[model samples]
Target: MSGDDSLRAVFARHRVRLLLAVVLLLLTMLAGVGLLGLSGGFLTAAALAGALGAGTTFNFFSPSAGIRALTFVRIVSRYFEKLVGHDATLRIARDLRVWFFRRALPLAPARLGGTRTGELLARLMSDIGEVDGLLVRAVGPLLALAGIALASIAVAAAIHWPAAVALLLLLLLIGIGVPLLAVHSGDAGEAERARHRTRLRTLAYEGLEGAADLAALDARDAWRARVDGAARQLAGDDHRRRGRLIAGNVLHSACAGLGLLAMLWLALSAFQDGRVTAPLAAALVFLTVALLEVAAGCGLAWQALQSARISAGRLQAIVEQPPSVSDPAHPRPVPASPATLSFEQVVFAWPGESRRVLDGIDLQIRPGERIAIGGDSGCGKTTLSALLLRLWDPQAGAVRWGGVDLREVAQDDWHRHVAWLPQGAPVFAGSIADNLRLGQPQADEARLWAVLEQVRLGDWARRQGGLSAWVGENGATMSAGQARRLAMARALLRDAPLMVLDEPTEGLDVDTAEALLVDMAAALGPRSLLMITHGHLPDGVVHRQYRLQRGRLLEVGGEAQG
Candidate 1:
């Protein structure tokens, strides 16, 4: 499907609200036009009556009452137009953000690994904001003006057909022609501005996040210069687009002036020929003027339209990328009974490379066993864990749980059976209980403490005021060892059958690391374990050890005895 197809679907979801906003906008503009036209006719007729010395016989109450009623309609419609339009815009913004996360999440790490976090944020925030304001900014104004133009032409026709014809020609030229020109000339500028804006946001976000590193490395000035360059480029593009918008407005005004003069000539000619009254001629000119004023906004409306399309396309591009791994068409349920995990004859390599990262790999972890694999950097240690996690399928052979190939079951199902602790596991800002509950949301207070003690953080928790104590953002309130144990407690709390810990003691001292493993080794009842780390483990941490060298697994300890 095309990039905009998803946008069309989202717009369709909120169609009713958008349509109501358009109707309200139309009412406001049309009522304003009608009020002005009626006022013009009443004052003109009143003056004429006075000129003819017949003022006492003229009735002013009906025209004046009509003007008051139209005035009230205009006021009320304008209020609701803003209200309903703003409401729809806000709702669209909320849905677009939710939609972005829903679609972009599934492609994480696999398809979107190459994309920067800041660039993705730019799309989610900046680009989506552009699309989210569509109803109030672009669609409503254009439709309301179109409605006024049509209604004014019809009213003029009822009074004088020739004047109606003149107004119609002018409305077409100014209304359609001006916006079309703005859209045509400003399309490229809008796209460029959006690109530069995204770049600027990305640069600023990255710079702020890495500010300390930038200063420490003495590269702060370089990053700041890049950010400033992006900002200047964005400003230049904005200036150009504004210039185009001004030119379109100028053309619209010229056309509007010519339209008024032509309408005046037709109205006067028809009045002289007795085709219409003097008040009617004046009212037609006033109506034409009002319609032209509304039509003048068409340039901005079309410009907004072009910008929204560009932003929508950018948001859609991220959502449209195909994931490297996907669930099978027919997935078999992962077995609930305890089973063995095995990789048989597995061979794999990184994409776009002929060198194999893993070759002729065969291994098995029986129920209730702990296995440790250590290797030099880039020896496919992490790749082996990733295969078990089923992030990517091996190019050859199969990974199986309970004799069922990993690819045979859904990825989510497999994930439910194994808990993982990545190296740089995040410590979110929340109470100790809150962070613990992330692994198992419904975990009770008792279970929270139990897991905390298992990872040797129970004493730390009590000292800090128990589970309710607030953890600062990114564990700023805690030491590296404390955060690592917190992550370990979270992982240990899961009800999964197998656990994978990638350097669970990362950033911790030897004493703390050994203490954590000693606690975990005793607390682990029957679940299997796979650890990828270079650290020396305390005895009983694992039942077996293997060192992977040059893409081959060599058992260094605990070789199975048949």
Candidate 2:
């Protein structure tokens, strides 16, 4: 489904609350009209009774009681309407963010890597907000507005037909025509405002993320200028959009005044001609007033609808992009046994490039074997691991697990057979245990401590108050070497047959890196290890070493010393 359809699906999940909000809004609007019309008629009747010497057949108590009832209904219904509507909108926003992640997370590095972080974030944070609030703030209220307009016209006709005709024409103009004008004039402005907003967010995000680089290069001033310019453009678009909105308000107000005068003229004529009582004629006028006042909000609601549509389309564009790779039509499961991984004559290139990154690559890792592959940056060592991980299929060959082609196996099941430690693995804002659980959610404390000890972080965890201690965002509280070890420990926690570690010893001192590899090699009991790095390894860490350069892998001599 398209993103717009998905957005509607999110709203549909809260349909009961949305419908209730509409009903409450309708009741609130109807009560307002009823209150005013009732008051107007009662006042006219009382004045007439006053001139008739105060002994007339006027039931003042009943009209007074009705006025109080409508007043209470309006206040209570509107309060609950706001409460339910806002609650539902918040729920939808929460669901939408989750849905966005579910769809976009799989595309990471392969598809979404080309996208700007700020632009992607703008869609998640800004665009989704526009869609999530539409049902509550605009669609429901507009529906209720229509309901009240129809009911008001019916009441006007019952009192006097000509007045109803006049009221209907004016109500249509106020409800439909004014909103159309607002949307027509403001469409371009709305789109421009959205672009400027996204641009501003992108600039702000880049400026902050690259603040250190900008400061070092003396370019912070230029980045700030770009942000300010984007902000000014956003502000300008907003001003123009609101200016169009004011035009709609003015048009509605004019129709309202004209509707009031027309109703009054018709009502007074009918009463003089003995067609309606003074009280009923007065009610018709007040009813027109109440309905038009409510209808005055239609322009803003319509504008919101247009803005939400633009935002939804933006969200849809991203969510609907085809993944670089897809699962097979009939994916088979990996065999539940000790699996041997092999790359057979694999040829590969990036998505939009002609140059091969892995050209006719071939390797094998038997169960419980330790193998290390080393290469310079951009030499496709990581690409080799990626193929084994099934992030992308080889253009010309097959990656096999226990003689079953990796493409034949479902990605999730294949992933379960291998544990990955990517170069840029994240340490999320969580406890050490929480971070470790990503690799092994059901791992016991003893196991967690064991893996931490394996990665040379056990003593550090103990000093930091144990597993439950807070780790700052992106492991901000820890040094680079500590965070790197934490990520390694996470991968180590997974009980997979194959472990792929890309530059595993990164950010550690020379002694620490070699020592960590030694412990990792010792800890590998019957598990095959494929470690990728350009750094020198301690002797006896791996059974063999291979070199990758210019898209070819060849058996190499010794460690690549830093």
Candidate 3:
């Protein structure tokens, strides 16, 4: 879907609230116009009546009552206007964030490889914030301005046709033409401004995140220069936008002045021709001044609309991007038989790369089989795991489960049947139990401690106040081995039929890595295990060993006891 369509759909979800907000805004504007007109007419009529003495009379009670009524309407409507408008905008802001997150999740790691973390953060915070103004600052104001302009024109027409024509011309030029011209001239610049803003945010966040490493490598100065460059670009873009806004504001003020002059000329001519009374002429003048607020609002609303369009486009780029791997149109049911994973003459390559990461190769592991595949660094061991997980489809042949092609089954269904532990699996900033609960949210404390014990983290958990203790940011408080094991514990708790452990013992000493492997073996109960490692696996833990070389899996050891 396009950005505008997506934004419309999001707003449609809360259309009632937004509609109410706009209506309230319209009422508020109308009240302001009415209050001004009534006050001017009442004061003018009272002055004329007093000057005429006993020769003329005026009804003070009626005009005074009208003035009081309008004053009450203005106050109440303005209050509700702000209350409802802000509520709608804030709600849409929250909903848009959630919507973007839901849309972006399936496209991660593969399709989003080129997207930076800081850029996405900018979209989530800044872009969404700008778009949130679509309801209040743009849509609501435009709607209210249109309504008030029509009402003001009709009131002017009641006094005289020339006055109405003058009001109509003013609304058309100042309210519509000026804003349209401003937006058309500034759209591209606004979009570019948003881009540079995102870039600056990305650079700033990256600098902060890597500050320690950059300092250690003596590259902090260079990183600072890059950030400064991005900031300068952002400032230039912002300055351009501000200049456009200032120009639009100046044009609007000029139009409003000309509009008021035209109205005054028309009102005076009508009063001399006896078509309008002195009080009515005064009312027309005051109404024209009040309606200028609507004109000013139109100019600001158009500027906001341009900014919102840019932000919407940014959000749309990520949420509407097609996933690298998509589910089948007519998905086959996941096979219920004991799971067996097989690679049948598979060939694959990364996008834009000439050489294949995996060649035509075939392998199979039945239920209860524990196989270890080792290879030198960069031999595509991790790529093999990615293919099996359906992160990307094989360019040729197929990875199958129980003789069914992986592509033939739903991705979620296939994932449910396998537990994957990739290298550098993240430990989120939460309690130990919170991290483990990701595997099984409903798991009790007993199960959590059991898995922790299996991964040899039970003692550490106890010392750290058990599952409730905070793990710090990304498990910072834990040792590298402990963090790795925490990730393993999460995977172990999943209890899937197929388990793929990629470098599970990475960063551990030989004895420690081997011991972890033994513990992993004891924990495996009738499940298929594919252990991809760069180092040695524990002796007798695998039924077979294959070394990946030149994109082919070659058996390097005889069948051994598990």
Give the whole-model CA lDDT for all candidates, comma-separated.
0.87, 0.86, 0.87
Per-residue alpha-carbon lDDT of model 2 for 1-562, expressed as tens digits? Answer: 5455475677788899989989999999999999999999999999999999856889889999999999999999999989988888898889989878877888876778788999998998889989888976689878998898788878888889898789888977888887897678566677788889999999999898889899999998888999999999998888888888898898778778877888889999999999999999999988887887788779889988999999988887787788767888999989875868888889999988999998888888888889999888998988888788877789998988889998887888788878899986899998999999999999999999999888788889999999999899889889877888888788878988889999988777898788778877877778899999999989999998999877888778643322
Task: Provide the TM-score for each candidate, comma-separated.
Answer: 0.94, 0.92, 0.94
Query: How does model 2 score by TM-score?
Result: 0.92
What's each prediction's clash count?
0, 0, 0
Clashing pairs in 3: none
Q: Compute the lDDT of residue 136 as modeled in candidate 1.
A: 80
Candidate 1 lDDT, 206-231, residue by residue in tens: 99888889999999989999999999
User: Alpha carbon lDDT of residue 222, candidate 1?
Assistant: 93
Q: Report the C-alpha displacement of residue 457, candidate 1, in angstroms.
A: 1.5
lDDT of 2 at 537: 88
Residue runs of model 1 more than 4 Å from their true location after superposition: 1-5, 55-57, 509-511, 557-562
